[model samples]
Target: MRHLFTIALVSLLLAPPAQAQNDVRFQVLGGDEALRDALIAASRLQAVTDEEDSASQDIVAAARSDYARLLAVLYEQGYFGPDISITLNGREVAGMSPFDRITQVRSAAITVEPGRAFRLGRAVIAPLAPGTDLPEGFRSGAPAGTVILRETTEAGIMGWRTQGHATADVGNQQITARHNEAELDAEITLAPGPVYRFGTLIPRGEERMRTRRVLRIAGLPTGEVYDPDEVDRAADRLRDTGVFTSVGFTEIPNPDGTLDVQAELVEAPLRRVGFGAEIQSQDGLTVSGYWLHRNLFGGAERLRFDAEISDIGAQNSGIDGFVSGLFSRPADLTPDTTLELGFRIEHLDEPTFVEDTASINIGLEHQFSDELTATAGVFARYSDVSDNFSERSVWMVGLPLGLTWDSRDNAFDAASGWYADATLTPFTAFEDGGGVRATADLRAYYGFGEEDSTRLAGRLQLGTVDGGDIAALPPDWLFYSGGSGTVRGQDHQSLGAMQNGVQTGGRSFAGASFEIRQDLFGNFGAVAFYDVGYVSEGAYGEGASDWHSGAGLGLRYDTPIGPIRLDIATPVSGDGTGEDVHLYLGIGQNF
Candidate 1:
């Protein structure tokens, strides 16, 4: 019974006080508006007093703590000497006992006297590594801001670490304030441990994945000078494979002066499935889905199968579809290289042509960096095509090479940076002889305004089939310049080159699109865009061509995954420019 009584008493003292109203006032007598705001933001009493449930005890506790907190804030702002006081209900809060129980906070007042700001009389950091760039304010005669001292010390330590001093740290700090002269002197010393080399990478928490594969993918340069960046990159590589939900690295120093890094990983589920759909009023609806296996053989190999069906309920084009499968193995030849094998079968039914095609490709992709990659492949294709001009069976073999640079902030709806993809394929067709197909798609985005509320995006697309007979090439290999992808507000495949009074896919194509987007209320945004496309009878815009353009307005509703897009467009220029409007709906930005 006595123990129970003691427990109850302790619980009462520790329990939160009952709800009460508070009126808090904070003033800075010798500071500017910025300093005053900072001090207020740093005050715990000011924060709690704004809450309706703040009790007298809570207010008193917060007020007492505010003394040190406010002083620290002032020092960070170059004020070394400060006086702070807080009063609650006409009583000094600091004088209140911890067990004092009060019913209501009622009112509290805070005052701060910030003395003269201090400038750096002597600022020195010893043994900085070569090429270290410290903060500009960490110099004599500059404001002796406390943050500057921290920045200087951190820079000094980081500089040593970058030079393979894995254990670099701040050894000591000496600070002095001469109150009479309003000056401060700060000295920092760094400890640069012995330079070390990288040992081996140890995998941890990995299930089902091969440990050897993990080490291969990480590509930690064992026996080389230790680099923090390399460790980070190794972790990134594992994450990019999509086999890991989380990846982190820990460093352990060995007696022989080498650092053994451990990769801590959490494996993601092996299988994933996704579906998407898009629609154009004239071209019809398209739906696609994919099934993926992230670790096909416990070696971070990825296998994916995709299928798409299109032209549903279309007014013009016939139904079209494709099925494809891809297999990729990471760390194939080198740590940054990946081997890819793909197979695709496609059927196209357009007003101008109907074709059936099958293709197989083997390729390698090398990552130069996070934003750049290069690919080379060999492919074989078989096609049976029928058009107004001819019906033919064609076989082709090609070497395809590609380079991609992607720095876009977002792939689905980019707000800044640029994306460029260029592909060149040299093929030998049984009917059309040898030829080369080249295409480049470049896009750029710029964002301004607060929180990037306004953005401007642009895209340029160029394609050409050179050194081939236009009539004998696979129909799908040719270019058509009408549809939601080219110029909206026009019928699918409406614009093509004319040969012997028959409209056919062009040998060359060019398209440009520009948009100005503005974020509206909530998750909604508005866009105005213009698109222009040109199709030519010969390669590289060398022959006769026609240009068509469209202008449109769009609306976007943002979601967790991506933005849903709705666009209304009409032909603005060209032979068929008219008031006919077209509508498009999709899950992502048009580009």
Candidate 2:
């Protein structure tokens, strides 16, 4: 007969009865402090005995069930033999019958005597798959904890399953305890049913999305060896399209040594609309809204239109507005590729220039992995400009190439990981010669302390426009500093390069920012930040340049979508130089 005890899952807390009270006192003998605490926590009597309305029958039931629960806890800690006793009002709970229940209960006592800890005499598992790694403590002469035995067996089973064995499981397990020698012997065997291949992918529960598009988006590998990782990746690809409210996969075994995958999906609503607003002391107010259609033609194509107005009630600049539209189709050329068509018309009124522009772009974005993507687009644009320079109408053609890598924990409020984006655009003008513009944004975050209560984040931004004079290019394509997005404490576009005694957006720019955030209490947090910016008339900070710095403190309130942010800052160096304070309100982190 097996000497080891069998463990079963049991609910630790029982519902309290009304109109009765009972006190529970627990003790553990012949055990260390850690063992005593574990036994008390595992006992059901200790979980609910303090309830003010616990009935006598409820208390008795809890005390009776605690024997198995406490024994299981002891076995996990290498204690093979344990003596457990429970009494109600000095009467043994084990001897009482359910039919003979007392009307009221006063007090209950639980005592546990954990015997000597055991060590493994022999631990073995046969025929493990290649590259299977078991727990470090699963070797002979180590502490004979039941958790180690369970983990060792699970690792063995999962190893075979990764090698195209879909039905791998435990064949047999033997666990024996020798009380006299304080030793345990554990042996396990795994059953790898068969090597299977992928048969077909079937979609279910989809109402609006076409079945062919679903297959294209998922791109499940048929006629290939069944891989659990591939199955999971297919599910992730479906979810990333944002057309499904819920997505899941099920495996069906076939008689012909193949596995059929069933994709269950719940399609989301076709249309969505949302709006957002942000305000800064100098930059003024920006309000934007978007409308999106998830399944425009029943093939998971997304059509979206966006509009924005900025510089409302500002002291420095006139109002600016734009309307833009984008059409995107997934799996256009490859399973990971998306085709994009975009159109935009905009009017800009700034301190140094006023312009109207219209543009159209066609592009392809390819997702190389979950964290990396590359894009290439060709655009045609027309712009009419009026500035200190002569007014002119310019027509241009450009090619934009970009790459992005993001692994942040949260895009809105990241606690860890890195994000980087780089874009380079080359253009040819109808009247003037061609030039190239390049920009990059990089950010990193690290979290420490309990539950990531503290985070340190940093960002770097760089921009340069080369192969043309500063006055020859579109003013909006140039760079400006001293705003909420750069140096928060200074006026919007206040710092720029000087050419011909006139201040204008820079040909080169560089900025760096850092913040330390700490959780204060509840959903509230505090942050301290420092920012520095530089601009020059020549590319790559070559010609005359100026530097400015700002420092501030902010507060944050967490929400489901993101965090509500409020910041107050002032200039610390260069122009303004600690003279004025600026306030900003927005959603999500400053980055």
Best model per lDDT? 1
Per-model root-mean-square deviation over C-alphas: 3.4, 6.3
Per residue, candidate 1 scores C-alpha lDDT tens digits across 413-463 of 889999999999999998668889999999999999988999999999999
Show model 1 residue runs off by greater than 4 Å: 1-95, 107-119, 143-146, 177-183, 575-578
Give one digit per residue, the lDDT tens place, for model 2 in 1-591.
133222211211242333444456788888799888888778778766766666666677788899889899999999998888888778888888765546556667888888899999889997799998989999989998889998898889888888999888988888899999999999888898999999889999999899999999888889898888889888988898889999999999899999999998999999999999999887789999999999999999999999999999777899999999999999999888999999999999998899999999999999999899999999999999987776878788999999999999999999999999999999988678989999999999999998999999999999999876556678888888888888878888888888666788888999999999999999999999999999998888888899898999999999997899999999999888868889999898999
Cα lDDT of all candidates, in order?
Answer: 0.90, 0.88
Give residue 11's lDDT in candidate 2 (0 to 100).
18
Model 2 lowest lDDT segment of ten: 4-13
| Lowest summed lDDT window (length 10), candidate 1 | 16-25
Candidate 1 versus truth, CA RMSD in Å, comes to 3.4
